[model samples]
Target chain A: MAEYAAQGKLPEVLFFVGCAGSFDDRAKKITKAFVKLLNKANIDFAVLGTEESCNGDPAKRAGNEFLFQMQAMTNIEVLNGYGIKKIVTTCPHCFNTIGNEYPELGGKYEVMHHTQFLKSLLKEGRLKVEGGKFKGKKITFHDPCYLGRANGEYEAPRNLLEKLEVELVEMKRNKSNGMCCGAGGAQMFKDAEPGDKEINVARTEQAQETSAEIIATGCPFCMVMMTDGVKAKNAEENLQVMDIAEMIASADDL
Target chain B: MQYIPNILFIIALAAGIGYFTFNIRKIIRNIKLGQKVDASDHKSQRWSNVFRIALGQSKMVVRPIPGLLHIFVYVGFVIINIEVLEIIIDGIFGTHRVLSTVLPTGLYNFLIASFEILAFLVLVGVILFWTRRNIQKLKRFWAREMKGWPKNDGNIILYFEMVLMILFLTMNAADQSLQSLGVAHYVEAGSFPISQFIVPFFDGLSEGTLMVIERSAWWLHILGILAFLNYLYFSKHLHILLAFPNVYFGRVVPQGKFKNLASVTAEVKMMMDPDADPFAAPDEDATEAPAKFGASDVMDLSTTQLLGAYTCTECGRCTSVCPANMTGKLLSPRKIMMDTRDRLEEVGRNIDKNGEFKPDDKQLLNDYILPEELWACTTCNACVEACPVSIEPMSIIMDMRQYLVMEQSAAPQELNTAMTNIENNGAPWPYNQQDRLNWMDEN
Candidate 1:
């Protein structure tokens, strides 16, 4: 972004790598895969690169208004300073916050989840998705709460998956009625209260009911939770949880 | 002497309607006790919701069996009430079969037959509903929050409908019998498609006896309806009246967007603005009342939220779909809404007793909805989506959590730590902000 500013050349999009995308070891792969797809498509995108900060989703969702505002204001100032116009990210939390909540605080941008952005690119013929080795594989897509129910974008990820020519099965609870992955509302940071069973386990069992070899999801939070769920059931040997970007980037792999 | 029944019907009618109006006003007053919010925007969208969700019952049909049965009861409830107008007119004017004289006999018969069929369907619907609650004993109906009054309230409302339908049919049967008897006041009014089955039950009764059965059933049926109207104030059956308006004012924005606290935003801006002087004195006349961060009691919640509480049918659709509740967590979104309503009513009573809210030590937070229950929410929006009436339990949970974090400084320890980390490191985790770009360096 700094180099682009020096050249006075605006990138087509800003890849807003969120906290999990930047720091979490597993989520970093999703960020990398998304970046590779961008490069492969030859899209001019820039990262804020040490200038970006937290988007205040966790704090806001957790009820710390003071802390949330402080974080939001800081990020808004940075995004506004660059006159950022468009954003794409792998994290639904960031995608949701920056897209829906930031306009009130003076940071306005055309924000899209990676899946939506990728879908638009495919529509524009900039990206061509091939079935390749992933053809005919049984896969189920988990709808992230923020992207699906919160923002009503259930089709973008599923639409992209349809290009894989895979046998796309659905859990009984899908679309608007989809179950939660249990890591939302800052639950990823805190221990869950006592319960008979974990939410992720329940949702994962639903996915397994379809006998899908892979549980494909778009959000980093769902990735972590669903992975843990597969492990909980000792089904790791048979089941795999991969992000949408990870699946697309590794379409040739089994 | 014939006017005595007319006089008694008028008195009962006035008392029933008069008390219902009084109670409705009290409810309006109680709802206004909450913080005011502008629901005046989004007229078209809100109207669309009123039609699609409230009028059409689109969301109700998600669980097809109960949904369809509910439509039977709901549509039947609305359409069958048209007969109440005729009953009122007849009761007031001492006119028998007045509608039969006004409309074409065919049209009147059609309407009457339609009402009778609807009445029968409503009876069947309520019976099935009772079975689902008592016989089938669905898990949602038997949830922890549904043990006592809620349980009986469910049964009582069903019984109210069942009895009303039976009375309607019986009244029709007796009236049709007198029409056959060539009685003077009978006037040959309605087509008795459903009540014809019950007509033979009065096989040998004379004119006086038949009139007695007819008048008694007429009085009980109308009186029962009036009583049911008043009973709505106390029962979850309030949904019958309030669902329309509650859904009209439901959350219109995206589910993920939590409204920022403007008061907190003002302070945050001052802190962020480098040009502002640190030593500047605060404005004296800005306001004297301390800024409350989020909802601690019913008074702090928005009127829409309070309206939502009263609108909840206790259908448990929200609770059944809730991730936290399904996982056996202490949280039940239905319980949150119900608890808010209970606290709000309590506040209403306090205000009524003392002419103003004299702070009861009990509040919605700890007194009704436990912190544990609030914390269990994953904020997944399942409950919000599952609501047939557009009631938002998640927003209430978020607002109470805001009160917990901002007003009381009492969020769970890990959450506080996450907030602190975001403050220091610009991330919820304890990672350096410089490392935000470190992943880009990886070969």
Candidate 2:
């Protein structure tokens, strides 16, 4: 972004690699895979680097409105400073916050989840994807709450997956009825409250019911939780958890 | 002596309606105890929701079986209630079949015939509903929050519908018999497609006995409806009256958008301004009293939420779909709404007894809804979406969470750490902001 500013040129999009995409070892792979696709598409994009901040989803959900507003205001200033008009994120948390919750605080931008962005890129003939290793492999897509029920974008990720020609087996719970991976509402930051079963474990058993080879997800949070779920069930030997971006990148050999 | 029954009928009608009006006022006052919110936006969309979700029962039909049955009872019951107007006028003026005298026989007979058909359909719907609740024992009805009065209240409502429909049919059967007997007041008015089958039950009866049966059925049917109307305040059946308004005020924006607090936004703006004085005295007139951040009690919640609580049919659709409850967590969205309305009613009684609310060492938070239930929610909006009437149980859960975190400063230790991480590292985890671009490296 700084280099682009120096050149007095605007990038086509600003990639918001949220916290998990930046720090979590597993989610970083999704970030890298998406970036590879962005490069392949030949679209100029910039990252805010250190200037980016949390969009306050976790704090607001956890009920710390004060901290959430501080973070929201500071980030709004940075976003408005760069005059960022468009954003793409690998995390539904950031995608939802920036698009739905930021306008009242003056941080308004056109935001898209990476799956939606990738689908659009494919639509415009900017990106090409073909099933290489993933052809005819059984898979199930988990709906992220923020992306699916919350924002009513249940089909974008599935639209991207359809391009791979994978045999998509749906869990009993999918779409608006899709069960949460249990890491939302800042649950990712906290231990599970006392319960008969961990939410991820329950959600994982539903995925296992379909006997799909891969459990595909779009959000970074769902990625972490579902990966942990697959491990918990000792199905890592049979089942794989992959993000839609990672699946696309590997399929196209990007 | 001839005018005595008319006088008694008038007295019963006035008493029934008057008491219902009194209770309705109390319910409105209790709901008004909650805090106010702006439900004035998206006028067209709100009305559209009223049509789609409430009037149309669009969300209900997602399950198909119960949804369709409910629509049967809903449409049948409402359309059938048109006959109640005739009953009311007849009871008052001491006239029999007044509407039949006014309208062309074809339209009048059509209306009566349709009402008879609806009455029979409502009977079938009620019987199936009762079986589903009592015999099949749906898991939602047997949930922990539904054990006591709620369970009985549900069955009682079914019984009420069953009895009313029977009385309606019986009344028609007696009227049909009198018409066959060439009785003058009964007059060949209205069709009896359903009740015609019941006329045989009066085979052994004489003129006096048939008249007695007809008069009793007429009186009991109207009075039974009045009893059901009053019973609504104490039953989950209040949705019959309140679902319309509740759906209209439902969240119009995308469900993911939690509200931004204007009060907090203003303070943050002041803090971020570089030219602001740190030592300056606050403007007394400009600044209002510091408001409590979140809800620990029913009064702190929005009136729309309170209205939602009253509007809850306790169908338990929200709880059944809730991931937290499905996994055996303590949380139940149905319980959340029930507790809110219960606590609000308690507060209303307190005000009624002694001028205003006197704190009773208990509140909606710890007393009615436990923090464990509040913490169990993942805020997935499943309950909100599953609700047939657009009741937002998640909003109430989040508000209680806000109360715990902001006012009580009693957030879970792990959550506190997450908030701190956001404070220091601009993320929920302990990642260095400088490393945010580390993923960009080819390695």
Worst 10 residues of 2 chain B by lDDT: B434-443
Residue range with the least summed lDDT across 10 consecutive positions in model 1 chain A = A245-254
* Candidate 1, B209-297: lDDT as tens digits: 99999988988999999999999998888998899999899878898888988998889999999999999988888777878989889
The TM-score obtained by model 2 is 0.98
State candidate 1's TM-score: 0.99
lDDT of 2 by residue, A1-254 (tens): 77787788778899988888888899999999999999999989998889888889999999999999999888889878888899999999999998988899998899999999999999999999887888899999999999999999988888888899899999998999899999999999888888789899999999999999999999888988998998999999999999999999988877
lDDT of each: 0.92, 0.92
Per-prediction DockQ scores? 0.88, 0.87
Number of clashing residue pairs, candidate 2: 0
List the candidate 1 regions with Cα displacement exceeding 4 Å: A252-254
